[model samples]
Target: MSFVRPDIIRPPSEHASYYLPLTSGCSNNSCAFCAFSFTTLGIRDLDDVKREIDAMSLYAKSRMWMAGQPDIVYAILRQWDGKRVFLQDGDALVYPYPRLMEALQYLNAKFPALERIASYATPQDILRRSVQELRDLKKQKLGILYMGVESGDDDVLKKIRKNVSHDQMVEAAKKVKASGILLSVTVILGLGGVAGSEKHALETARILTEMDPDYAGALTLTLIPETELYREWESGRFEMITPFDSLRELKTMVEHSTFSNCFFSSMHASNYFSIRGSMPKDKGKILRQLQALLSRRDPNMLRPEFMRGL
Candidate 1:
């Protein structure tokens, strides 16, 4: 088997997180709006992955030792207060099933109190996994999945070469949820650019309502270097939506969403408004807050254009 190495790995800001780079880059690396194009895609060797996990486990322990704190080890030993792991690179789900399962099991064995293992997966990966397999994987503690359902609009999907259709995404999401895994799906605002913004927003909202993932995140479009999006901007084929317009699109999305268990978050650095709310209950409140912001169009309510790059 081929092997890949990652330059660096770090934990996410939230939770007791650690990033394990199972795959160097994304498997479906054709998204036009993605910066992942700059990175090469390859699967890492299983032995290498085991070594990485062992190293991370040691590192986590060393951190506790260096801190000279009892709380750290206590945190690890506590059942509900276990460390959360975020499998990294771009698409760690691209790892083979047996190897991925073994890695998760190994982590659990090493950590003893691992709360959950999360990873980024494309819709195609979900479609490929059987429901029973996903359930079994979940039983082994692969609890959360972060998928980029960037847009639900078929036109936008085709344009970006996301390689999945609206129907497929809906089905995949349902299966993921049914398997009892928390779904944190990301949707890109302004992917439709000026012309397709409304359609993108409405269609994406429709899908979100239908799929009703556990967590829904929205990211404003940011042009990055060496990305097809940047090239498109240079060639004048792509026109990015203003922060105001993106928020407007976001409102439309929130307004149309019917998902109850969903937690709407845009705390990502890229989005204009870091507005966060829960759904089915806080839906109306969140929508009203968003609408008020839109009506007021307060400059301070949005992230400035200069700070919007990801």
Candidate 2:
């Protein structure tokens, strides 16, 4: 199939980044809670990717528009400060290794001034490459990877169809660290629901401590309609945790996980509350905030249900 450009889903931190699509869906798309589960992965043609890079370079250099290029290209370039590039779709790192390298090489050659390039990567994708392979990409300015590790509890992982185990994710994080590329991972609070929330939170904290990622983010499970998890919720097969319960999970994770200078946050829109601080240093402060909220159990203090989003 001819690769279709995917939508502009990206990390919150990549607000200023230029979206570059190398793939259109995730390699591991069976995760029950994800919207990408409804889509199939598509690898863009390398020549097409290079053409977009060329257009971006042209626009950056002379504010010229390339014929046949989508207007979105120029639209993005208009505000782009020419620093960060974020690969798009569900998992752009799954793009064929050689082509991915070539694309980055071309990107760097065109915009040597780019500070960093980032992409969402699956554990399988990282495991498939050697440290040297990741190093090569880092040398080409692929500075960080965002990975979705929904839950670290093996039972929760299996139920969600994450496929990869806790050990595999930790291993992947290690490989990224070894390659000197920053690792950012996200885990979902309340993924195990009411019955298994405690174990889920504890195991997730264990995994986070083991991975020792440079950045860790906590996202609450916001069931998307038509998704398997949503259907399960509809049928009463899954129990959705309350806002306070979700905060409790977050607190447990924050109190338990140890990090070597990691930035941890629950700043995603899906979350009911946001607390960000350097783990270990800000651990006490973050905990006190969650504890205070838990103490009051004030619905008013939490983000309104209408405002929560995926």
Candidate 3:
């Protein structure tokens, strides 16, 4: 099948970067809570990827268009600032290592000014590579990797079908940091639902401290209609906590997680309330902020349900 370009879903920081697709869908697609579980992974041909880079180069140099390429390629290129490139689909690092290297080389050849290249990487994908292989990619300007840790509780991990264990994820984080790449991970608030909410938050905080990520984000669980998690909720097997409870989970995580200067945030659209701070430095202030919100228990201060997104 021909590669279908995925919609531009990226980290908020990648707003100025080009979206490059090395693969479509995720290699680890068994997660019960993920939308990628519904799609099959597709790896784009190396030559096809090179052609897109070539097209980008042509447009950067002469504002020319390339034939036989999807219009979205040019659309992203037009908005690109030439400073960063974010490889797309769910986990582009799962792309074949040699082919990925070649593609990055081709991209660098075409755009030498690019400061960084990033991708969503699954723990399984990172663990598949040797320390040196990851270092090589980092040398190619692949400076950052966004990993979805989801939850730290082993039971929660098992329930969500994350496949990778807590220890394995910690190993993956160690590998990324060893490779000198900035590792950013996200944990879902209230992922353990009502029965396991507190344990989920505490365990997640433990894992975050263990992972010691350069950046950590907290996302509130938003049930996607067709997903298995959503079905579980509909069938009453999964009981979601209230909005305030979600914030409480976030507060618990923020209060317990220790970091080596990590930038922690709950600023994702899926979050009930947004708070971000540099860990260990702004910890006191951030905790006080969460305490103030939880103390008042005001729904008016939280993000509206209709405004939230996955």
Query: Which candidate number has the best lDDT?
Result: 2
The segments of candidate 1 whose C-alpha lies over 4 angstroms from its true place after superposition are 1-4, 7-15, 57-82
TM-score of 2: 0.99
lDDT of 3: 0.93
- 290 in model 2: Cα distance from truth in Å? 0.7
Clashes of 3: 0
Per-candidate TM vs. native? Answer: 0.88, 0.99, 0.99
Arranged by lDDT with the best first, the candidates are 2, 3, 1
Off by over 4 Å in 2: none
Pairs of residues clashing in candidate 2: none
> lDDT value for candidate 2?
0.94
lDDT tens digits by residue: candidate 3, 191-306: 99999999999999999999999999999888888989999999999999999999889889988889987999999999888899898999999889989999999889999989
At residue 189, candidate 2 shows an lDDT of 91
lDDT of 1 by residue, 105-210 (tens): 8888888887778888888898889989899889878998888999999999999888899999999998999899988888999999999999999999999988
Q: Is 2 or 3 the stronger prediction by lDDT?
A: 2
Higher-TM-score candidate among 1 and 3?
Answer: 3
